[model samples]
Target: MERSQEYENTAWASPVCDAQEPRLAAAISGRRLPCFGRARPKKIAEGVGSLNVRSMTGRSREVADLMKRRKINILCVQDTRWRGNKAIDNWEMGTSSFFSRANKEGREGVGVVLNAEWKKHMVNVNRCSNRVMSIKLMYGKVTINIISAYAPQVGCSIEEKEDFWEQMDAQITWMGEEERIILGGDLNGHVGRNRNIIERTHGGWGVGERNEESENVVDFAVAFDMAILNTFYKKQENQMWTYCSAGRKSQIDLLMCRRNNLKEIKNFKVINGESVAPQHRLIVIDFEMKEERRGRQQQTSRIKWWMLKDQELKAEFKIKVLDRMVEAEDPDTWWTTSSRHIIEIGEEVCGKTSGKDPSPPRIRNLGVE
Candidate 1:
C-alpha cells in the first residue's frame, strides 16, 4: 500500500495487481513484496524490526545504540558527513564500517556498515560518484552484495541519473546471479514521478508504467535479473512516504534487491523517532537469509566442538583462562573440578608415560589401563 504512495506528487493510474509486478524469473512474481519505504505504515510496526538506514551523520552513537538494541545486521548510508581520516575512527567499537562520504570539502557521499562480526568476509569495495559505494561479502559460500547510493536531485536532472546507473551497473556486473544484491540510499526521485516509476509487485512483472527513462532503468534491472521490492500502501493516503520538505511528504529513500532472494520478509515498517531524529523515519525490515543457515550451523558446530576441546585440554592449554590467575603460576591450569571430564585426556597421557594399559582402568588409578 505505502509502496504506491510515493506517487502522491503526481496522479497515477489504478494500481497494478500484486501478481503482476516485475519478476526476476517470469514465474516468481510472488517472491517480491513491499520494500522499505514502499510498504504502508500500518503494514509495519512503528519503531521495531531489523533495519538498514541511509544518511546518518554525526549520529554514530545513536545509530550504534539502535543497532545493539535492535540487533541490526546491515546499514547503508548516503550523504553522511563522514570524511577521510575521522570517518572510521569515530565508529562504535565492534561494528565493521565501510564509508565513502563527502570528502572533507563536502561535495557528495555514500557509505555502508555491518556488525563487526562481518569483517571476516568483506571482499570487494567500490566507490562511484562521491555518493555511492558498493561492498561484497562472502560468508562461507553465501555472498551478499550491498550498495549505498544517492541519486541526483531535481536540479541535477534525469541525465545525471541516467549517467549514475550507467557507471554503477558497469562496476557491479561481475556480481553473480545467486548473489543477493541490495542497492539502497537517498534515491532523490519521488514515487510515481515521470522518471521515478511505481508499480505493483504482483501483476505484469514489469515496471508498472514508466515515462521513458524510468522504463529504461527498469529494463536494465530486469535484464540484470533484479527484482524491485514492492510496497504495501496502495498509492493512497495510507502512505509509505520518506521526505517531508515543503510540508509535503513523499516516499524517496529505498532498499532494493533481487526479488526472490530475500528469504522470508516478515514485513517492513517505518520507525518514527523523536523530533531530533531525521524527518525520514527508519524503514525497518525483517528478513531471514536461508542461505546463511548452513554456514551458521557449521560455525556453531565448529565453535562448540573447538571450545569444548580447548576447555577439556586445559591441563595442557597454555592460554590463560583468567588474567589475574596467570601471574600466580597456577599449579593446574585446567584442573577445575568443574571440568573433571577432561581427566580422560590427562589419564591417557599419564598411562602412556607410565607404561600402563589405557583401557585396563578403575577410576582411582586412571592412568593405568
Candidate 2:
C-alpha cells in the first residue's frame, strides 16, 4: 500500500492523467501544463469593389452610403466625371474619395474611395491620367496598389484605345513583384465563357462572346501574370453581369489581381438590385489579409532565496521538505523529487519577491547631518 501511494504521488502518474484530467495532473505534479486555448492569428477581411457610377456629380453622399451599407472597404469608381485631380473626404459618410479627371467635365474620369478604416493607411495617390488612377496603401508588411481605369469604348478611335492600354501597361510594369495589385475598371470588353488559349489569365467562367477589346484585356493579364477575377467564380447570368442598358446586358466592368494572390480571394460576384448607377452594377471581391504574429517576450520569476535568513522560517521549511522526502532508484528522480519538495515547502514558508526592483535602503548620513 505504501509503495502504491508513493508511485501515485510521483511524476510517473502524471502522464496517464494528463490526457484525461490535465488540471489534476498539473496539481499533483506541481507543474503547469501548456494551454491549448491560445487565440488564433487574426485576419483582416476586406471587400474591394468596382462600379461605373457614370457621373458622380451630386451623388457623392449616395455612393458613400452604398459603400457603407454593403460593407465595402475599398471601391474603384470609373467615369466619375469630376474635374481636376483632388481628394474629397465626406466626414458624415466616413469615406475618402480621390479622383483624376480631364480638364473638361462630362468626360473620362476615374476615382478610388476608401472607408475610414483604410483611409489612415493610404500612402499616396497617383493620378496617371484621366482614364487611370491608383492608390497605394500599406497593410502591415504588404503594399497594396489599387488602380481604377476607364478604357475607351468600341466607338472610340483606335489611337484612343491604344493610349489607354499603354498607360495601363506602364502602371502595371512599374509595380514590384512583391507588391499586391488589384485592378478594377470598366474595361468595356467581354472575355467570354471559353478558356481555350487564354486559360492562364481567363478563369473560364466569363459571359458572352470574346471581342476585339477582349484581346487587350486578356493579353494584359497574361503578360502581367494576373487573373481576371470576374471569370473565376461560377454564378447565374444576373449575378455575373455588371452592366445593363437599352434592352441589353453585358459584363464590361471587371476586377483583376495577381495570379499568386488568387488563393486569398474568398468570393467574387456582382451585386444586383443596387441602383448606384442606371447602367452598371457593383462587382465586389472578398479577400483576407493575414496579420503577422509578433514574438512575445518570455516572463521569468525569481525565488526570494534571502527569505531563508529567518531562522524559524528556514527550520519550518527544512522540516516540511524532510517530511515529503522519499527514496528514489535513480539520480534524476531523486534530484527532481527533492528539488520539488524543497521549492514547495520554501514557497509555503517564505513568500516570493515580486518581479520588480525593490526600493533602495535608506542611506545613513549621520556624519553629514
Candidate 3:
C-alpha cells in the first residue's frame, strides 16, 4: 500500500459526489490514487486543465512536470506561439504534446498535452488552424473530442473575431453526435457574475463585469448548449480569475463543455501558484470517465500433420505414442493421452508447421481470381 501525504492551503470538491474532499478517478494501474495538492478520496472525473502558457517550445518539459504532479490526464494549452503542427513525445517530460500553429507567423497557437496513459487512447488529431485544434480520444466505447482553441483578443478586428467563432463552430459541427466535447482555452471573455445567474448555461459564479467579448462568448455557448464550467462552481475571488496583472485582473481563459456533461464534471478552479505564465493562471477541472472492462483470453496450440509423410518421423511418433499408451490406465485414456504425445515427439523429429496454410497452392501465370 502507498502512504498518503497531505498538503495545506488547497481546497478540493466534487459536484458529482458532492463530497467535501473530492476523490480522483482510478489510475491506469487499477489503484485509487490521491491528487498532489488535495487529500481525501472520492470518485471524481479525470483531471483536465487549461493554461495560456504563452509559449510552449522551451517550457514543454516544465509544463509536463507540473501536470504530472498535479495528476492531470489531459491539458489544453493556448498561446503556444509556434509556427507549425507537431507532436512532441519526449521521455523527460513523461507526456505527449500535440500543437497546431499558423503557417505564416508564430502567433495564436493552441495545443494539448496528454499523459503517457492517455496518449495511448488517442484516436486521431485534427489541426484545423492556428486558433483551432481537436483531438479525439477513445476510452472504450466512448469517443471524447477535446478541442483546444485560442480565440481572437479584444483588440482584434470584428471580422477576425467573427472568423474565429465560425471556425470554432465548424469544428464542433464536424464531430459525431455521440462524441462528447470538452473545449477549453483562452476565450478572452468574461461572462461576469450577475448576468451569469440569469443565464441557463452559466452557473452564476463568474468574476467581474461582462464585456462585448463576454457577451459574444455567452451567446456562442448558449447557441451551442455548452456550459461555462468556470461559472458553475463557487470559489475564492483569486481562484475565479484566470488572468492577472500588476493593476488589472480578469477572467478570460475558460473551459466549456456540452451542457449535458455538466454533471460529470466535479470541480473547476484556478491554481495561482503555477510559474509557467505570469499573466495567466492554470485552470483545472475534474470529471469522471467510464473505463471498459477486458475479459481473459483463451490459450490454444496446433500439431504438425505434414510430418507424418516422412518414414523416420512416423517411426519416432509411433515409439512416443506407444510409450505414452503403455503408461495410461485404460484404452480410452491411452487414446486421449497418446495423440498429444505423438505430436510432441513429431515436433522434436520434424519442425512444426506455421499457423498459415504451410504449403499454399502455387499459382503459375496468375490471373484475376
Candidate 4:
C-alpha cells in the first residue's frame, strides 16, 4: 500500500502521557544527573532523520526496521523514555542505539540511532540531560555533532522552558566553530511561514502561524547562526505537518544546521505513511559531505604518471606534446601552450589514475644485507 494511504488508514493513538514537563525542581536544586556512557568514529550520512517516537520503550525492532526500509543512516529520536544512559546494539538489524532519560521512568528522554556503517565512526555521546542528548562523529577531517532534544510543551512553566533553551544554548556554544551540527527534535513550536525579523534563520516555507514558543526556536537559531532546515523546502500540505492528533496538526518537529552549511542540504521534508509513532511522523534531510565530494573529484582527476615508465607510451606522449606545442608570440603564451599541451597529451596517452595508486612502492630492509 502507498505510504500516504497507510498513514490515512493508521489509527492515531494518543500518547501514553503528555510530554514530560521540564524538571524545574531538579535544576533549581542543582542536582547532578548521571553521565551517560561514551561510545567511539566519523562518517557523515547522506540521509539523517528525526522522530519523536513518543516512547521507544518496546519499539526498538520497529524503529530499526523503519530506518532500514527508509535508508536512514542516522536518526535523532526524542521522547525515547528509555531510562539510563547506555548503548543498545541491534546487531541483527545493523543499528546502534544510545539514550539519555530522567531518573524516573515514563518521562522526557532523547537518543540517537546510527546504522552499522556510521556506528563505527561515533566518537562520543553526551547524554546532556533527560531532554537533550548529543553524539559526535568524525567524518574525514570534519567533526559532526548530532543533537536530539525534547523541549517543554506549552503547558510547562516559563522557568522550565527557559531552562531547556539555556541547555540548548550551552550545548551549541560548547561546540568549536570548525565543527558541524545537525540538531533534530520535537521542539513543540510553530515557526510558521513568515521569516520577517528571523529571515536569516528561517526559510519561510514553514506551516501554521508563529507563536511565542516557536519564536524561542527562531531566536535560538539566529543566535547560533543555524538555519531551520525543515522550513527551506516546499512540500505537500500533508507532508508539512510533523505532528498530528485529534484532527489537529502542526509542524513542531524540526531539523537545523549551521547557516553557512546550508548548501550541503540537498533535500528536507516530512516522511508520511509510517506508523512507528502514531502521533509524530518522521522528517529527514539529505546532505552531502563537501570534503568527501572534493576528495573523490581530486582522486579521479589525478594523472596516471606511473604509466610514463612504458617506453612506447612515453614516446607517443612526447610526440603528441611536441605536435600540440606550436611556437607562441610571447614567452607567457609559449609556456602556457607548452604546459597545456603536455598535460593534455599525457592524459590522452596514459589516461587518468583510479582513486588509488595501482602500484605502491616496495620497502626493502638493508640491515640484513
The candidate that wins on lDDT is 2
The residue-by-residue lDDT of candidate 4 on 1-369, one tens digit each, is 699898878756655455544442322222354334422112257699999988877888888888889889899888877667757775444565554555366587888888888887789888778898898998777889999999999999999999899999989989999788999999988989988988878888888898888878988998999999988888877889998899999989999999988988889978888888989999999887655333333334567766777777778888888777688789998998788888888788877756576454533432322
All candidates' TM-scores? Answer: 0.55, 0.68, 0.66, 0.66
Flag clash pairs in model 3: 23-42, 45-287, 45-288, 46-287
Runs with alpha carbons beyond 4 Å of true place in candidate 1: 1-57, 84-90, 96-98, 157-159, 193-220, 230-239, 274-277, 292-369
lDDT of all predictions, in order shown? 0.53, 0.82, 0.78, 0.82
Q: Give the per-residue lDDT digits (tens) of candidate 3, residues 309-354.
A: 6666677777766666556568788777776776667677766545
Which digits, one per residue and each the tens of the lDDT, describe model 2 over residues 269-290? 8988877797899999999866
Better of 1 and 4 by TM-score: 4
Q: Which stretches of candidate 4 lie over 4 Å from their true place?
A: 1-44, 91-93, 292-369
Q: Write the number of the candidate with greater TM-score, choosing between 1 and 2.
A: 2
> lDDT per residue, candidate 1, 258-280, as tens digits?
66654445555555662324566
- Local error of candidate 2 at residue 351 (angstroms): 49
**What local lDDT score does residue 115 receive in model 1, on the 0 to 100 scale?**
63
Best by TM-score: 2
Question: How does candidate 3 score on lDDT?
Answer: 0.78
lDDT of 4: 0.82
